[model samples]
Target chain A: MFELILTLVLLVIGFVFGQIAEKRHFRSIIQREAETRDLLCFNERRIPQDMFSPHVTLVCGSVVVSVDFFKHFVATLRNLVGGRVSAYESLLERARREAVLRMKAQALAQGATSVWNVRVETSSIHQGQRQGIGAVEVMAYGTALVPR
Target chain B: MGAYENRTVPEGINVSPVHPLKDFAVLLFGVSLSVIAFVIVLALLAGYLVRYVPFSYEQSLVSRAVAPWLEPSTDPLDQQRQRYLQSLADRLSSVMNLPDGMQVTVHYVQKDTVNAMATLGGHVVVFQGLLDVMPNENALAMVLAHEMAHVRYRHPIVATGRGFAVTLALSALAGIGDGVMERWVGQMGILPMLSFSRSQETEADALALESLQQSYGHVEGAAALFEYAAAETPVLSLPTLLATHPDHEDRIRRIQVFAQEHPPAMAPQLQPLPDYMKSKAKSNESQ
Candidate 1:
């Protein structure tokens, strides 16, 4: 009975904490996305030589994200019915946005008009022996172009 | 599609569009992982609960699943032997009061193992080795009744359900401990092979006895198989607790006590086992 109660408490904590954290992250992500709107980012490999100036270098941003207990519990249940895990979807979306935002900030600092040839990579890192939470690392890299 | 390729920018607008393979890959990986997990967990749960629900479906499902593995032997001798076994089962089941299930159809699988099992959809599988050892009609009836009780109470269904639940729970708990998942997975592998609860076994035994007395007017060789095992050292070495069914001696004692309380109308006389079966047993013993 005590164990059940403890589990319930942990679950409640996970839910509350997860909600607050996710909300904060989404708000920040949106703000940064708006700020970085002017900075052009392209996945195209070919550089627009006419638009491209001489000053070019590498810019990258990396971020790590881990899910809360609530999402973990939901994922476990979802593992039973099997469909889209929106809880996890948002987790990745946040991490990806954060990584891109950091990259955009770096490009702006470099005085580049836009970013091109963008790439994103993600790797999962699970930690905690008995009660470990798994985390994902998302890294965004791109070439910044400063037009003359 | 619109790459610069050393040309002038058309709109001089937004940067390149996303061609996110890695993102999709992760999504696919997560979804596939969840789907696999869901299938295993749901199957386990459904397999457990399906017994309580009555249907003719389980029988056909199991038969179809096992069809490819079995050699389709339509030999006359085999058919005759199977018919005999089925007729005996039909006779035994006619006397043994059952719930709403079909007349038990006993299948004679030509395996040299001393075992019998009752499964979903009123199917009783009798091994050739079991027929070889039975000493008399009464002994055979006793085995039949025992298996019938399992069908009556849906013991197989309950057992499978429990096995599935145990496997799922153990795997879930594995996340909390070091080196626990491996052990849990190993245990899941063995849980299905376990026997029903001791109480379920006891119920089946008691019901079998009731059935034996009703059908034959006495529980004569009800304890014959266990007695044989006791008289001779068994090949396998398993403790009573580990055995799914109760120890034959203990079961015999229970039968005797029940018999004393409710004596049969006719005193049972020992009948000799059939010569063919006896010979088979003898051949197996020598081998």
Candidate 2:
């Protein structure tokens, strides 16, 4: 009986806090992306020959996000039924967007006009196979070009 | 650089548009319903198929576990009580027309718990507390016949098989989650199992009433045990849906109905319990 009550309480907490945190993170990512829009980033590797006195360097941003109890529970159930786990979808989206926003911010701080060969990578840092996915790390990296 | 520009993409494209809660609700509903349905079907299948398993195999499987139940008592009075109870069960089984090779062994427990149960291997354990409440031998026969009916119908093995299958499924699902997930899954599984068990109780009751009519020429004392049960337990019982046994009142009403349909040709005679069985007060003092 105690375990049942604890599960319910934890689930409610996970849902409420997870939603609030996800919404806040998405809002921040959008605002930051707007602020750093001029810091162009692309997967294209080409560097323009017309630029004078170009300074090139590496810029990267990475963040790790963990799953909440409620989403984890929903995902576990989803595993049994074999369907799209929408709960984890938004978490990944938020993480990937935030990583890109951070990478753009880093380039803008370095006075870079544009970035090239931008790439994003993801890895799951699991507690263990039985313990489930504890967190995911997303990194965005690129070559920033600043004109001197 | 001359023509390329990083245009801001639209929001909320990567993630699904469905609300998480809505997704969760649908998945929970669908999964729970399927699990319940699966368990019920599996239980029914297992229950039906388990009777084909030879009774001797079940007896061997439970021989070690029920060893304590079959242990002989050192006290002379207890031995005498056990013999008397065994003789009564033997008489009941003779009239019950149990299937060939299905033997009923009655064990007398000196404990104070007012309960009796039919378990695997055709072993029935009746507690002293229950015998204390019997107003006559007919009431005692009803209790014994109810358990014997469980054996005759192969309910113990069917229930065991059903439980085994259901637990296997539930545990397989539970392996994916931690303690909380396991508990949640177990809770969902319990509802169907409870309903199945209640129906078994009702079926056993019907058979027991029939056996009582055959043995006693009427079921005049068949409801006496239930009367004691109703009086001893508080009136506030769990609803019939949640209870393992049918409600005491409902069981009594069923017996009354059965009595009306099969009236005795002569005045009903309620045989007194043996003198040794009469000392409910003495048994408690000895304990």
True interface contacts reproduced by each model, as a fraction?
Answer: 0.02, 0.65
lDDT of 1 by residue, B15-42 (tens): 2232223333454356445434554565
Model 1, position B82: C-alpha lDDT score: 70
TM-score of chain B of each: 0.70, 0.90
Compared to the true structure, candidate 1 yields what TM-score?
0.50
Instruction: Please report how far candidate 1 places residue A117 from its true position, in Å.
Output: 44
Clashing pairs in 2: none
RMSD of each: 13.8, 2.7
Model 2 gets an lDDT of: 0.85
Question: Over 4 Å off in model 2, which ranges?
Answer: A127-129, B60-65, B232-239, B264-269, B278-287
Best-matching candidate per lDDT: 2
Number of clashing pairs per prediction, in order = 3, 0
Q: Return the lDDT, model 2, position A84.
A: 83
How high is the TM-score of chain A in each model?
Answer: 0.92, 0.94
What is the fnat value (0 to 1) for candidate 1? 0.02
